[model samples]
Target: MLTRKQHELIRFIQTRLEESGVSPSFEEMKEALDLKSKSGVHRLISALEERGFIRRLPNRARALEVLKQPEDISAGKTAVRAAANSNTALTALKPALAAPREPANDVIELPLHGRIAAGVPIEALEGQATLPVPAALLGPGEHYALEVSGDSMIEAGILDGDFALIRRTNTARDGEIVVALVRGEEATLKYLRHEKGMVWLDPANSAYEPQIYRDSEVEVQGKLAGLLRRYH
Candidate 1:
């Protein structure tokens, strides 16, 4: 089995490839892995390649191609030839860890704009608000952005200063964090619970009570895809 450092390196490489559509440079690897120097990354990379977990092309920049994911080789099967593409390589080397075969989903790059208050209506302000999140995170509904207003969601781990990713909808799955426009005038963040003809916006912390709403009064903005926290 590969050591923890190797595992981390594999994951880092995989993420970089997915993001950039190519392998990272040795310098990038060194920075991402926090190695002392480029040579350190090269040594680990060579070790991985020797183990049949990766492939490298001579004299090519970003030449390292991950041939075996941790799960693939972990099953002890690096002997057989698999398909010739990166996806196949991942599956051949680690079938158990293979990601689902799905089409590319849309991911929005949201900026980390300013904050809003839960207790009062405030003017919306825009600043550096760029955060990339998968389209799947947005519920099957319309798209919208909400300026977080208060600390009500804080006890629930939704901070007051965070930008909440919101999708516009009226229906929400149970236990999903949602942006709900309550009473047509105010918005709040809470977990959704649909039952007994009533929808409940449950808070992550016990300090706040669940916001109950009727089918008509609740405006499901969208499932909270995710949040971006910024400090300046």
Candidate 2:
């Protein structure tokens, strides 16, 4: 059985990795959890590592890998369920709750294009399927989904195996996350930075370096609208 803090830390790490293809930095972990020092982050990471929940890659920065799947952790909730059940009898006298809500009609179906690299530009491929998403999340305009395939944008909460919803457009504002085709060769999902006659694809993870290109050599495919994740 894990302590409350341990469980919270594990969940935080899992969420961070899921949202961004990379593990959270120690400072990030500390700040998120409101820990007093970096030593607290180290101790928690060590505990999780010893329990086979995560692994630290050798000779790499911010290279922690999740060993235990989210499903496995969720399966350990028997105790929590039992505690909830214990309160059922006490609340039984309360009025019954309202009926279950029906599915909303605001769900929009979008094409799921094959994987796109978050770490580096890769050739864009035809979509393999379609997925349903909330229309409010996508806003207006033509949109599509692409599965993220790298940890380069982990710090930005875009993770491997996550679906990034992109609005189809040839233009994007500076500092926005966008799918950029470099030299008409491949498309990469990254934060766009514009300088004098130059465009830079910036990764959110420290382990990877930013890519610089001439403004004329890059084409904007789409701007990121939202993200989706399914834990199994």
Tens-digit lDDT string for candidate 1 (79-178): 1222222332211111112332322244555454445444333444346655454443333444555557776655433556555655556666786666
Off by over 4 Å in 2: 1-104
Report the lDDT of model 2 for residue 213. 94
lDDT of each: 0.56, 0.69
Per-residue lDDT tens digits for candidate 2, residues 37-59, read: 99998998898888877677554
Task: At residue 183, give the lDDT of candidate 2.
Answer: 86
Candidate 2 has a TM-score of 0.56
lDDT of 1: 0.56
Q: Measured by C-alpha RMSD in angstroms, how accurate is candidate 1? A: 14.2
Listed in order, each prediction's TM-score against the native is 0.45, 0.56
Q: Candidate 2, 20: how far from true, in Å?
A: 13
